[model samples]
Structure formats: C-alpha cells, structure tokens
Target chain A: MKFKTDRDAKLGYWLILPTVVAISTLIFYPVFYNLWLSMQEVNMNPIQPNTFVGLAHFIDILTDLDFWISFRTSLIFTITTVIGTTVLGLAVALLLNRDFPGRSVIRGVILLPYVTPVISAVFGWKYLFNPVFGQANYFLVDILHLFPQHINWIESPAFAIYAVIIFNIWRNFPFAFLMILAELQSISASLYEAAEVDGASAWQKFKHITLPELKFVLGALVILRTIWNFYKFSEVYLLSASVNVLPVYIYEKAFASYDFGQAAAISAILFIFVLGFIMFYVKKVLEW
Target chain B: MVGKNTILKNIIFVVLLIILLTFVLLPFVTMLSSSFKPDNEQNTFPPQIMPENPTMEHYKGVLNPDIFPFLIYFKNSLLVAFLSAGIGIVISIFGSYSFARLEYTGRAAIQRGVLLVYMFGGVLLVIPLFQLITKLGLFDTRTSLIVTYVVQTLPVSLYMLGNYFRTVPESIEEAAIIDGCSRLEVIYRIVIPLSAPAIVSVFIYAFMIAWNEYLFASVFINSSQLRTLPLGLNQLFYTQHYVWGRMMAASILTAIPVIILFLSIERFITGGLTFGGVKE
Candidate 1:
C-alpha cells in the first residue's frame, strides 16, 4: 500500500506534533535548563536572579564528605536491592515455573507486593517494624528471643538501610519474578529432556539449559533495575529519612536547605551516572 | 512406582512457596487487620495478627473532616489520574500512529530519542521542572501536576501504543485507503477499534503512573487543598500523633483502587510493564 509521499510526510508531522512539542518543552528543555542551572547560583527568592558561578557548586559537591557518604550509601542501596530483588525473584520464578496446582493464583498473589501503592507498602512496613509496637519486634524480641531489645529499624541509621533494602526487595522482586517467569515459560522443554536423557543431574540440566537462555533478560533487568534503584527516592524517603541515598540527599539540599544550585550540581552528576545506564539500556537492552 | 524423592521435592517446593508467600503478605495482612483493630488493641504487646473485636471507628475517623480530609485527597488523585490518562491517550494515539504507519523525516530518530529521554531519571529533572512550574505560575495547582504527568507518561505511552499499533495488520488500513478512505477516517473508523485493548492498557498504565507518583506531586503541590493521596498520607503520618489504625485505614484506602485495577488487568500488566519497565 502506498500513499502520496508529500501528503504522508505532512500528515506524519501533524500527527506527532503534540507529543514532540510536549517532550521538547517538558523533558528536553528542563534537562538543558537543569544543566545551565547547575552552573549558576540559584536562590529560590524571585528577587535574587541566578548568577552563573562556573562549576563552583560541582567542585563543592565533589569535595564534600557528605556527598561521598551519600554516594556510598546510594551504591550500597542500589547494588544490594538489585541483587536481592533479582535473586529472590529468580528463586520464586523457578519455583512457580514448575507444573503445580494453583500456580496462576499464587503468581497473582505474589505481584500484590509490587503493585501495591508505594506509600501504602512503606507505611505498612513502617508499622510492622515499629520499635515499640511493631510485629517484627514482637516476634524477634519477645517470641523468638533473637535480640534482647527492640531494634529501632526506621530511626537508627545503622539498621535503616537494611530496612529500606528489605522493603525494596519485597516490593520489587515481583517485577523480577514476572520478567524471569515470562522468559522461563518461553524456554524449550526439549533441551531439558535431552539433557536428562544424557544422564545429567537436575542441577546440570538447569545450569546448562536454563541459565544461558535467561542471560539476556537477566542482564536487561539488572541494568534497568540498577538505573532505577539509583534514583529511587519516594520508597526510601517514605520508609526512613535516616538512610540518605543520593536522591534523598539532593532533595534535602534543594528543598530543605534551599540550595538549588548545589542540588542541581549533584543532580547533574547523578544525571551522568544515569546516562551511562541509559546508553547501555538503549544500545544493549532495547537495541534501538 | 514413583519414589520418595518426588514427594520430598514436592514438600520442599511447598515449604519454600509458603515461606515466600508469608514474607510477601504478612505486612499487608498486618495492615488490614490493624486497620480494623481499636486503638488500644493496635499498640498491644504482641501485635495481634487479627483484631479480636473489629470496629469501623478508624474508618469513621478517616472520613471526619476535622481529623483529616481523606476524601479530598482521594478526589484529587482520581482527578489527576483520569485527566492525565485522558489527555495523554489522545496525544499518544496520534503520535503512535505516525510512528507506526507513516513515513516521515526524523520519525525513527524521534522515537528513539523519546525512549532515551524516557529513561532519564526523575530526580535529575526535579529542580528544573520545579523552577519551570513555578516560572509558569503553576505551583500548587493540579494543572501543574497534570502537565508534568503528561510529559512523564507520554514517552512510554507512545512506545506501548506504537508497539501495539505495529501489531495491527497494516493490510486493514491499506484496504481502507484503496477504498478511498482518508488517513484520518481510517484511524477513526478502523485503527481505533482494532487497538482498543492496547489503548485501555496504556490508559491504565498512565493512570497508574499518575496515581502512584509521589516526587512530582510532592514538589509541585504544597497546598493542603491540592495535596494528592501520597503526599497527604505522608503529611498525616508525620504531623499527627501516631494513630496506627487510622493510618492503616488510609493506606488501605489508597491501595484499593490500584489493587482493583491490577486484578482486572492482571494479564496485561507484565506485558505492558516489561514491554517497557514501568517508568519510575
């Protein structure tokens, strides 16, 4: 089927105009504006005009120990959560992938944690880990005697990161499970059958047949999840303020301290890290 | 003669499944049960899994205006979700059609550009978007949230719709064209009907994004009157005394719409989500 080339081109531009315009003004423009703001002293007071400071904020951020700490915290949070969610998700996917009764029901129920509202999930966990009255403390301290005292999961900086990681894994593993399960369902059973006929052990069959087939999806999930968990703010912030990942650090800088320039600088640095993943994602995962 | 090995393996699988299920559901069950418990019972020593005497008092408290304006936040969230989905779907339909069917300069590049930009983290955009919103005098307004959500959701919505559009048989549209149907007529008469499921999925996806969104809502909206559910819940959690039952009730209320949405479209979710990772 053919159309008049000139007319088709004209119609195409017209059709895509709204989306292009919206993306330009809302996404691209803000991104460039963010870069410009990163180099300026941006006081929130409308009376104070932003003055270009020529990378001073970036230098300050680079030198700051707090920024480094937050970077470390972000790295730990992202790495742990990505690994935790992926491993847990894969384990569950393998379990559910087998022929079983009520598997579909179990799959649906498993996704509840992931699909539930973040605020709700976070608050629920906060209540569960409430030091004084949380069920977790009740079980650990009173019932099981695992600890002598109620551990303040949300407030104490020592344990808060772990709490946040647990919350993240619980909330996110379903996504990994869903993806891996989809891929798992696609693998040809004949390979496993052939391996079994060759007198292979169960582990050998899985190692030989399953792992290689899952490599691409797993790679994509890890990279994508790494990019996402790096900037994850709401879940961590809502769960605990003590565990200051980079996003929370930047938020505090901008909104709490009113240091827009420094915030932009930190964000600019964060953008570079995110851009690395985005490039990998575009080239490697999407292959676009 | 099936051996004991099969039964042992089955037992292990069941045990692991039960453990995972409990880990996943314990918090939700705790929240729901606590929401029904009376205040005194909620803070008991061995936090009870089930409220012995359930009451609607906390639910009543949630509805009380003097306590918290729960309904207002609910309405605000619904408005934002629906408005974004409505406006976003319309724009994405045309945009996706262009990408999927029409030959145009920069079409491929633009589509790829949208995908890359879509992957840009929201935290990086917060400061500039805030400034942009304030500069445009849209701070503390629903319009600001709606506009930002449209931008946040458009790329993925276009991607999903465009992917689905490609799956629609091109031959149908060509047949229409040969019958002298204009492109606009073909879209209206033929394309849309065939693409209804994807449109619904995209609409639900956009709605879910707007509904669950916290960062943009928190930044752009400051007025108590304009607060969405997540922000409102956060404020309630922090500002007031710890009322576990009422807080749980509010949390449950917040999740109901989303849970219902998911259940109805359970199948489409994985396909849509992994089609592109749920943006933010």
Candidate 2:
C-alpha cells in the first residue's frame, strides 16, 4: 500500500506537470522578462542606443507630468465607472429579478453593451455624439434646445471622460447585474415569506435579508470590477484618440514614439500600482 | 395597505427597468438608426433621432473596396473567436479533469498556482510575450492569436471546469471503474456525458473573452487580411474620419455574432459566473 501510494503521487505529479510548464512559460516568464526590460534604457531613438540603466526608465516616467495626468484619468475613469455600473446593475437586477413580461428579453437586452464589440459600440456612440451633424448634438440643440450647434464629445477633456465613462458603465453593468441577479435568485422565498408573516415592510425585508445575503457577492464584484476597470483600454482608445489614458499612453509611448524604454517603464508602473490595489482589496475586502 | 405598497413597488420597478433598458438599448438603437441615414444626413447639425432620408448608401459603402472588405474582417473575427473557444474547451477538459480528479500529489498546489496566474492581468505580460511571439515568427497570424489566447483564457475555464467536476459524484466514476472501464473510457463515457452544460458554459465564456479581445489583436496583427473585427473597426474609425453612417453600419455588423451568442447562452453565462464566483 505504501509503494502504491508513492506511485500514485508520482502519477499525480506527472499529470500536473504540463499545466505548470504552460503557465510558467506563458505567464510568469513574460512578467519577469518585462521586469528586466523595465529596468533597462531602451528608448526609441536609434541614435541613443540601448543601455542598461537600472531604474532610469522608472525615474523618467515618475517625473513626466503626462504620465501623472494619464494616471489621474485612469483613477477617475475606474472609480466613477465601476461605482456607477455596480449601483445601476444592482438597481436593474432588483427591478428585473422578479418575474415580469418579457423578462428574459429585457435581461438579454441588458447584456448587449457588454457583449457588443468595444470598437463597434464606440463607433456607434461617436456617431450619436457627433458635435456637428452628430445625433447627440442634434438632439440637444434641435429638440431639447439645450445647445446651439454640436458639442465635440471626444475633443473636450470633460466630455471625453464622460463619454468614455458612459460607455464603460453601459458595457459593464450587465455583468454586475447578472452576478447580483443570480445571488438574488439564491435567496430563499421562505425568508421573505417569514418577514411578511411578521408584517415586515418591503424595504425592511430588503435591508435585513437581501442586503446581508448580497454583501459578499457585492464585495467581490466591486473588487474584481475595480481591478478590471482600472486597466481598461479599448473603449477609451477607440472612442477618443486625443484624450489620453494610461494604457493608451503606454501604447503611444511604445508604438507611436517607439520609446520602448518609457513604455516598459509605464507598464511596470501600471502593474505595480494595480498590484497594490489588488493587495489592498484582498486584505480589506476579498480577505484572500 | 399591502396592496398599495405592491402597486407602488411595481411602479418603481417598471420605471427602473425602463431606464436601464434605455441605457442598454440606446447605443444599439442609435447604431441601427444611423446605419440607414444618408452620408450627408449622418452628422447633420441637429441630431435626427429619426432619419428623414434613410438610405442604404452607408451599407453599400461598407461593402465597397475603398473603405475595407468589412465582411472579411467579420469572417476573420468569427473564425478566430470560435476556433479559440473550441480549442480552449478541449484543452481545459483534459487539463481541468487532470487537476480535479486525477489524484495528483500536488493537485491543490497546482490549482492554487493556476488561480494566481489568472488573477494577474494579461496586460502585464504583453510586452515580453510580444517579444516571444514575434521571435517565434508567428506574429500577424490567426494561429498566433489563437495559441496565445489559450494562455489567458485556459485558467478561468479550468477553474470553472474544476469546480463543476468536484460537484460531479465520484461514485459514478467508481461505478465505472468497477464495470471494467479504463480511465479514459470513464472520463469520456461518464464525465463528458454528464458535464455538457458545464462544457457549454466554458465554451461560451471562452468565446466571450476571445470575441471581445482587443489589445493583443491590435498589437500583433498588422495585415488587413488577418485583422480581427476590433482592430478592423479601429482602423475604420481612424481612417474614415467623417463616414459616420458607414462606421455605424460596420459597428452593427461587427457586434452581431457576440450579441447572438450572449442571448443564446444567457442562462449559462449567468449561472456559470455565479457558480464560479460563489464557489471560488
């Protein structure tokens, strides 16, 4: 039996070997390699030549005001969008959690923003918000009489962030709604029935029962959503080319300027910053 | 008093649902409406909620060679998404089962290891992997995208399958073993048959990830022929600055497959997420 147990353990190690190799090769190695690059001076200009300057790239990115601006934009973008999405998602989930006519259809519709390609959705949104002949400006000016002509949604910093926020909220809420709705479903009818039997009001029951049941899921969602929203790039990049965010800034730094050194520096900054966020959430909220 | 409260609740619920629905539908509705508008009417001074002169010119423009072979990009995206998701499902089935039920010595440790990988966002690894993929001479090809995509998606799918596998009664596998079934036969004949729902859910989740993937696709693929829908649409927007109607048409065209898939698997998508979230 001891010999057989030892052999079984060997078989288990063999079975698990491929997964470890694949993850290490594909994931861990890249991260370590990027860490190496982040420490080097591999700027875009050919005349400058690549140099091994430890922490120089990091120092440069730290001092750059644009990087700080992009960082601020990312923070505002992430916090605002995640909060809005979660709150709206919860409200929608509560509204449609119960049976109604065409509930499934409504649920399906809610997922459209999430399911739709970010590029396509942004394009459509740009058309709608077109300042000149754009439908958004047209509606505001012609119908609502709120504006005179059109508003440049993408060019202006404020509207650019707002548009991106709207897009992000629209895209993500469906996911939150789905998760919360599932949690809502798991809440037994008996709890609500008992509350009603005790003459508890709807709000009172929600506060006592539903809210408590939802806490963990909601907490997890907020953490996960915040992490993802912090790193989100596609919608903002596709929607507003001029309005810079951290990821776009990274892209531009690397590809546009060919400043691989600075790009690596920014990438490292993003990773560390977001990792700090992950640690904070894990400690405080996820308790991982 | 209860009746009045119920009525008020219903009213508030209806109002909330309508507002959420509008938020959800506004982009799609706008896209659909704008797609039919004539080029001149597309970006008019006052946004026309309803197109006065609806034309199919934008759709025609999308089809023309001047803009791009939008259809080809569509096909490329669909192909990549479906193929990657299919490949992912197959890989995870074997890998996940091995992790879950293969009685490996370091199974718990390996599972934790994989979960840690999943928690680290893919963006962190992009630069180095870009170097690796480029060095391998696989850049700008669907094959490269499909292979690397597996790395990011496999962990989540494995986690989902692992959880599902745990729920599956071990007694059944024991019964199969007693019936003179080989390990492979037991997995195929028993496990696969029972885990179709979980498998479908994994497939859909993978499909969503592949379908919505943008960053790598944008970075790696350069050729027009190989470009996925996301990258192709990015080009369309950047290149054709003023072609609002046609851009909207292309947007609608691009979104179709994902929209369809989500609706079809709405139940599984919700269920899978809840199961994975709570159990994890």
Candidate 3:
C-alpha cells in the first residue's frame, strides 16, 4: 500500500510537470525579471549596457507630473466605470428577471456587447462619435441641442475619458447582468411570496429580499471590475491615446519612448496597488 | 381598475425594453449599415441610418489583397488562437487532474500561486515579456505570440478544469483502477469523455481570449505581414486616406466569429463566469 501510494504521488508530479514549467518560465520568471529591470537603466543602445540605477527610475516616476495626472485619470476612469457597469447591470437584471415575452432572446442579445471583440466595438463607437458625421453629435447637438456645437468626442482630452467610460460601461454591463441574473435565479421564489403576504410593496420586497440575496455577488463583481478597469488597455487605447490610463502610459513609455526601465518602475508601482486588491480578493472572495 | 394598472405596467416594461435594445444594438446597426454605404455617402453629416445606395465596394476593397491583405491577418489570428488554446487546454487537463485527484506535496500552495498569477494584470508583465521574447529571438514571430497567449490563458483554463475535474465522480475512476486500468488510461477513457461540456466551455473561453487579445499582439508583432486582425485594422486608420466604409466592413468581419462563438455557447458563459464566485 505504501509503495502504491508513493507511485501515485510520483505520477502526479510527472503529470503536472508541463504546467509547472510553463508557469515558472512565463509567469514567475517575468515577475522577478520585471522587478530586476525596474532597478536598472535599460538603454536600448547596445554599447551602453544596462547599469544598476537603484530607485532612480522610481524617483523619476514619482516626481513626474504626467504620471500623477494619469494616475488620477485611472482612478476616476476605474471608479466611474465600475459603478456604472454594476448599476446598469443590476437594473437590467432586475428587469429581465421577470417573465416577459422573449426574455431568453433578449438575454442573449444583451451579451453581444460584452462578447464582441474589443477592436470591433471600439471602432464602431469611434464611428458613432466621429466629429465630422457621427450620429452621437448629430443627436446631441443638432437634434436635441444639448450642446451648442458638435463635440470632438474622441479627440478632445476633456471628453475622451467620458467617451471611453461610456464605452466601458456599454461593453461591460452585460457581464454584470449575466452574473447577477444567475444569482437571482437561485433565490427561492418563496422569499418573494412571503414578502408579498406580509404586505411588502415591490420596492420593499426588493430591498428586503433581493438586495440581501445579491450582496455577495455584487461585492465580488465590483472588486473584479475595479481590478479589470484599473488595467484596462485595449478599449481605451483603441478609442483615444490621449486618455492616458496606466496601461496606455506604460505602453507609451516602453514602446514609444523606449524608456524600458521607467516603464518597468511604473509597472512595479501599479503591481503593488493591484497586489493589495488581489490579496483582498483571494482572502474574501476565493476564500483561500 | 386592476386591469388598467396592469396594462400601464406592461406599457412601461415594453418602453424600457425598447430603450435597452436600442442602446445595445444601435452601434452594431450603424456599423453594418455604414459598411454597405457607398464611400461618398459614408461621411454625410447627420449620418443616414439607412444607406441611400448600398454597395459591396468596401467588402471588395477589403478582399482585395493589394489594398489590405485582410485574409492573411484573418488566417494568422485563427492559427494563433487555435494553437494557443489547444496547447493550453492539453497541458491544463493533466495539471488540473493532478490538482483535482492526486494527493501531492505543495498542491494547495501551487493552486493559490496560480490564482495570484491569474489576477496579475498582463500590462505589468509586457516590458519584461518583451525583453524576454526579444532575447530569445522570438519577437515578431507567431511562436512568441502563441507562447505568451498560452501562458496568459493557462491559469483560468486550469482553474475551470480543476473545478470541473473535482466535480466528476471519483468512484468511476477508482473502479477502473481496480479493474487493472492505469491512471493514464482511466483519464483518457473516462475522465475526458465525462467532462466534455466543461472542456468545451474552457476551450471556447481560451480561444476567445486568444482571438480577441490585442495588447500583446500590438506590442510584440511589428511586421505588417505578421499582424493579427486587430493590429491590422488599427493600421487602417493611420493610412493616408481613411475609408469609413472599408473600416466598418473590416470591423464587422472581425466580430462575426466571436459573435457566432458566443451565441453557440450562450448557456455556458454565465455558468463559467460565476462558477468561481459562487463556488463557496
């Protein structure tokens, strides 16, 4: 029995070897390498070898006004999008939870935005907000007269963040809808029936029964969205480069400016912030 | 009086549904209609909801090799997505099985570590990954993209598969073992067949990640011939003259596969996403 048990353990190790190798090489190595690169002067010029710079890059990033501005932008973008998507998702889920004709079809339709490729969605949005002929401007300025002039929604710095936030909400709320809807399905109908017998109004029943049932899922959704939106790159970058979220900022530093070390330093800082959230997520959500 | 109240409520519900549906579908409708519009009419102010004279010129333009070579980008994307997701799934199956069924030293620690790595954002790793890829002489190559995508996708694949494997009845596999079947045979003959739904869902999830991935593809691939669909479409905007019709057509084409995949697997998506959160 001992021999058989020992053999089973050996086979297990062998089975997991490829995954371990892949994770170690691809994940663990890069994490430590990124840390090391953060502390060095990684000049692209071959003649100028990488030198130990020891916190200089971090100091530079800390002092850079642009970094702070982008950091603020990231915070605002993340908070608004997280709240917007969650609220919108919850509202839609509640509405759809009832038995309506073609509810299933509508449920599938709702997920289109979330599941579509980001590039496709961003391009579609860009066209809608096009300054020259976009329907968004026509509707808002020409038809509704909400604004005096047609705003350059994507190009102008003032409105680009809002445009991106709107796009993020539009794209992500379906995920929230899907998750909340699943949880809603699991809630016993008896609870709502009991609430009705107690003379609870629709709003009161929702407040007492529905809200409490969805609390944990909603909490997880908010945190997950926060983490995702913090590093959201493709949608914002595709929409407008000027928005300058952290991921876009990091991309500009590394690829555009070739300031690899500074990019790594900024990444390290971003990683620290994300690590705090991940720890909380693992403990509270994953319960590990 | 009650009939009137219910009728009013139903009216309200229909109106809200219309508003929601319009919000969701308008962009797509715009993209689709614009794609069919003639080039001259595409930029008309107060953009027409319905095209005056719809034409296939833009689709022809996209298909024209000299203009975009979109077919190559499409092929590259398909190859990379399939290869990466396929490789990731195969490796994850064994790893998840070990985590699911085996009593091994450090198993719990490794699982937690994977979860942490899974949560670690991709942007943070780009610089080092770039450096590493360049050093390995794999930059600007499909292999680099595939390897990176596999790594990016592995954790979630493992998590989903591991959770799934645990749910599968262990007695069946043990019975096979008692019948003198090797563990490998048991896994191949029993475990995989039983977990088809989960395996399919995981594959679709990984494939979607690979297919829709833009960040790494944007950074790592530089040569035009090597560009994926997203990177290729992005370059269209920078060309000397931007063609709205062509651009819209390209966007629609890029989205079709993903839309098909999603519709086909609609049932699994909600289950897969909430599986982790609601597990407890």
lDDT (10s digit) by residue, model 1, range A1-288: 366578888999999999989999998998899899999999787346888899899899999999999999999999999999999989999989877889888999999998889989988999889999998888888999998899999999999998999999999999889989999989998988888889999799788889989988888788879988998999899999999999999999999998998998999999898788668777977676
Deviation in angstroms for A256 in model 3? 0.6
Sorted by DockQ, highest first, which candidate order results? Answer: 1, 3, 2
Per-residue alpha-carbon lDDT of candidate 3 for residues A1-288, written as tens digits (9 for 90 to 100): 222487788888998899889988988899899999999999784235699999999999999999999999999999999999999999999889889788889998999998899889988999999998998999999999999998999999899998999999999999888889889999999998998898999999889899989988898888888888888888899999889999999999999999999999999999898779778876987576
* TM-score, A chain, model 2: 0.89
TM-score of each: 0.97, 0.91, 0.96
Best by DockQ: 1
Report clashes for each candidate as comma-separated counts.
0, 5, 0
Model 3: per-residue Cα lDDT over B42-139, one tens digit each: 88887888999999998998888887778899999999999999999999899999888887788888888877675667888889988888888888
- The whole-model C-alpha lDDT of candidate 3 against the native structure comes to 0.87
| lDDT value, residue A141 of candidate 3 | 94
Misplaced by over 4 Å in model 3 are A1-4, A45-48, A277-288, B272-280
Q: Is the docking of candidate 2 incorrect, acceptable, medium or high quality?
A: medium
Q: Which ten residues in a row have the lowest lDDT in candidate 2 chain A?
A: A1-10
lDDT of 2 at B146: 88
The lDDT leader among the candidates is 1
Q: Please give the distance, in angstroms, between residue B82's alpha carbon in candidate 3 and its true position after superposition.
A: 0.9
DockQ of each: 0.76, 0.53, 0.62
